[model samples]
Target: MTEYARGLSHEPPLKPERPQFSSGPTVKFPGWSLDKLKTESLGRSHRSAVGKARLKYAIDLTKELLGIPDDYLVGIMPASDTGALEAAMWTMLDPARPATVAAWESFGNVWIQDAVKQLKLPNLQTLSADYGEIPDLSTIPQRNDVVFTWNGTTSGAMIPDTDWLEPGREGITINDATSAIFAMEMDWAKLDATTFSWQKVMGSEAQHGMLILSPKAVERIESYDPPWPLPKLFRMKKGDKLNRGIFEGATINTPSLLATEDYIAALEWAKSIGGRKALFERANTNADLVKNWIEAKPWLRNMVSDPAKRTNTGVCMVFQGDWYESLSDEDKAAVPKKIVKLLEERNVGYDFNGYRDAPPSLRIWCGGTVEAEDIERLLPWIEWAYETVKNG
Candidate 1:
């Protein structure tokens, strides 16, 4: 057993037989097995014919699942979602033009960091909200480029609706939809560029980023004169034309064929479950299962106080108490530590602790691969854990 698996303790009578509720890289794809890649030419050079074909398969499968537009370009970019976002920022955003970057959590903050600290872009506006709320898009200055994350994973918050996006306004809108891919509807017409990672909901391994560009994004890549130098990997549209070859499996660096096969499997699994509709239903069903239980019990409250913006994928919650509120960061960490340890000890759920930077709250991944039955199974254990730990 791997360290993660070994860490799990065996418990009888109430052994978890269904799916697990993990936030990320924790999906339970159907018939998932690492050994399936044994027939794959994963050992061959990425530049080899088989490797290229694998890369192409990954891209095509993603496009088909997502219903990407014909005119848009899809590429298997380097780095995870982080790298893909950075590449877009470095290559596409023009420092001279006014820019606005809105942040809600870590991922969005990273983009803001790159814009201000790293690239030192000028005429920039940083709009941010603390966890649950979102900045008013109407208040965002016009004639400025925009950057935002589709879902705030840490806060379990998301833009409640997409009607706020105004397409006619000038400047580009770059989105990091890493956890928002199939779980939410993406109006590609409103976004100039978007990025996502495979591990969050696709149940695939990490180390790959998928970048999709609108024609406007392509125009920006082709025409914009960035104030700084563009790295080789960040450069998307090469010399005023969309690099069509990249879409055809010409990755910037070597990609793992095994990972590609895993992604393909995830797509296949996604399709078998009835595409995006089923995907969203699964997420909603799982989240609703947890939310309904939380509502019935007075001991818990959702981290995102607002029900409208509460995310279905990363569902977070906090115990209601002055004791929890009165604790320092160290003491807060201790409570969650105790809670998670008990859960792990019972093999109920592993790694379901709150984010280190965020306030003490349980983070649950309720994506498509995580079943509603599992969420139902998890709630009793959470109650058991609270009782088991608090009594100590």
Candidate 2:
């Protein structure tokens, strides 16, 4: 039995008004209404003029929100973030040059697998770190194309800054920023290729990938031909020239016009709240609320020990009681599942379980869409659930 179980306590008085906090398809913007997308060009061919205009509007809004460089090309691709990343990898990676992959979590590991095993690159250097830590950026060779995830969503670890990247490197840097883009600041000047999905930070629909490429990355596509055969979805170049139309609203395949409108609505919401700075502040404030709660509760500790590396979007935590530590791995896993189930049953929170591949812990979505007051309300329920599970 745990100390919390024995202590005299009453259940928390309030419940969060909204309880949709899955990391992907996160809680929609506060006051989001489906009616807002009524203007969407529904049932229209994506190749039609109106459809093309809507797609272009989404691209322009993304550029405006992120402040992407004028030289960079932004495109909408198939298969969400994975598709954008795979397209970049297949189209830009030079078979002659060595490839370097840095993986600190599941998504990063996927890229590593693509480069090392799938592509079977001749020269490959893999830099890996544990769940809570980032791989050492200094070990990556400047001459080798490097691939890494800016934020490890599953692990709740994020790269603190772009200082680790060499400013004058000969090779390109491919970053998967699906969970990091709008919630955090990125040094765009240092990144050659960046990819994200609408479902992550913006709480929009899935299956659409946003691919951003620097001039250098575009040049790589035009200059170097990959040794592997390119799929239609992965091909970014037509003959020796880069496909310029793709960057200007021409998609490799059909896109969801409704999803495009939702993204536009999300971007408009972002603008209404003062854009990137406001979004970051919301996520940071929610995270700080949880951080303070974690400090007050001795039984809970952050999954990522380093405060600097902690993710503001996905706040992962573990139970720290001696009782919890004494449990077998299977029991430890079962405890979190019970706690999550209890929270859900009580309507206090939802999808608070850690990533399946990660350590048994609670992974809370603290992104812009989640309210700080709600996080404040939800903490007590979590304590109650944990105590109940521990004692039973």
Candidate 3:
């Protein structure tokens, strides 16, 4: 019997549309209930006392949820994780010291482009691996700064631990942990700087970036003299001094209070649900559901070659068999397309299609908002979709 037939079944009076498990802008929690968003209040002046209090409350709640260190500064910056990362990079890098970057995906490559190709930093170096693997950390240059993505969302690959980092390095480590924050464990003691957005596991609206800097990052910002002028948004340190106001609710510009409140609400929800343990359990449960399904079906397997390196949040898998390889280019492409279409037609999932840059692989979201039972129910629908498409 299918798991969906038992307690895993959806509640009666189903919506014409089913739940969503796409990469971003995902479905609300299965039992999440909230009042209408307070968008009207967002247009008012953010400099007002009430606005300031709300912003501060949001920041405080976020810090509590993430268990951030007391010395660290968690500030709201412009854009998403991209802006936060760029701000750190542009403001904190010291041209005098060598810089090393680990390029694993699209976002990592962008920073390397800036440090090496665009900025023309003479000491720039990159240790890159293919889509599914991480380059050897020992290969990174010593006595120089380093950059890496904790979770490569595009490739469904992740570095499971940070133990490889050398202690007492002369330079800093800037990490773009956009998808890894909250979804995975991050050791602040081992990292100098990190950036993330609320859109992923937090399930908040996009556009705002949360940049966290350690005391070491602060010291670098205050002492190092970069070869470029720092933009107001990216200004963490200036003239041998750290900008204290940026950490105290003085964002580069006014942000939507509605979004800020939503972020706070989400963080609060995270706390209420047992914090990191709850979040990690959800990912583990979801991944196990999909993995069990894959093991039962010989025709499909995860695209990530190593099971240990597989991402718990963004799960990617591909079809197997000579039947798949025997087909023409268009025919092979059509297999995943047909599977996606059938699933959509049944309203079981959306945006399960593989990334355009990658081979034919199904990308599913198993983030914080997703419940274990929902994932269990969704697996059968995948099998049904594949069969429906193959038979048709």
Candidate 4:
């Protein structure tokens, strides 16, 4: 830090074109504007002909954008990712079967709590790790129900691949893929129930979650009666059979037509840019910009020790070096607090601070909606802020 911190100009770096880097509800797609969203569906009952069609269109576009299997089901749920995941949990997971729930970050921890306390699964095996590290999930039982997150948004760590999943596995696998859907590879075959919200990789409006189910998951729901009572929002079954209307576009409750329009625009944007492949490339390109910047400097480092396990979206970082570590714990905490505050005050960055429960650090969104050039521009601002705060 001392070596590169010297002889630098006091002037601040050029501002990024868009300073939004929030992990969820991230920056919108380039060229996105209010006028661009469709207004025909606004103010209408979501159950009306026009509103239902609009909602279904978003679901169809999602399947097309991600190349989801035709046999699978995709539906819009309320309360964003949390609701979608919980719906799958309450309906699909059976109390009779032993299960494995794995988590390595804050949201993952939420699921662990759901299984242990909320669901009260007596035979659950909980796997977890501290922030910035991934728990080894390589040996989960093939016959044990499993729940895991594809990417830990708070930890900046991701499961690198699906090699751990077996093709002949009997138990269904539920995945929380909010941050990984567009930016990371999703091995659909290994995943039984997958959930995400438009607010993540697509950078659309929030509060609407997408719940996708594989054939195996649907079968489980049909045969298994929920041991616990489900709320109106979590009920996917209409009496004895699965409610197919939800998957076909009739939501349990009203959805924000405005957010639906914004999400549709995002999916359309994704198609124009070469679909899923292009989205992953853009996110990786932005992550690379940050990765290179971190390598070139001595003062900062990626929070994840293994580069392979880090997520392209929500890349987290922490300050390093003897001079910084030598400071008191309170001072270390203040460093990122001050750096983020300075950057935010200058409008050079926004919502890029690390998760509160984790160590004091930085978390930058490198999702497809964010441009690589903006990341390159923002790197210098981070360094400048770090120095400014540490020195003062």
lDDT of each: 0.78, 0.88, 0.76, 0.90
Better-scoring candidate (TM-score), 3 or 4? 4
For model 3, what is the error of residue 309's alpha carbon versus the real structure, in angstroms, after optimal superposition? 1.2
Best by lDDT: 4
lDDT of 3 by residue, 266-287 (tens): 7777788898778888887887
Comparing 2 with 3 on TM-score, the higher-scoring candidate is 2
RMSD of 1: 4.4
Model 3 earns a TM-score of 0.90
The predicted structure with the larger TM-score, 1 or 2, is 2
lDDT tens readout by residue for model 2, 24-136 = 97888888898888564899888899989989989998999998988988999999999999999988887789889899998899998999888888888988988888878
How much lDDT does candidate 1 score? Answer: 0.78
Of the candidates shown, which would achieve the greatest TM-score relative to the real structure? 4
Over 4 Å off, model 2: 1-9
Q: Rank the candidates by TM-score, best first.
A: 4, 2, 1, 3
| lDDT for model 2 | 0.88
For 1-392, candidate 4 gives per-residue lDDT tens digits of 43324324563546889999888889999999999899999999999999999999999999998889999999999999999999999999898998999999999999999998899998899999988898889878889999999999998999988888999699999999999998987899989999999999999999999999999998888898887889999999877778999998999998999999999999999999999999999999999888778878788888899988988999999889988999999998888888788778878889888899989889999999998888987887888777767676
Candidate 1 off by > 4 Å? 1-13, 18-20, 322-329
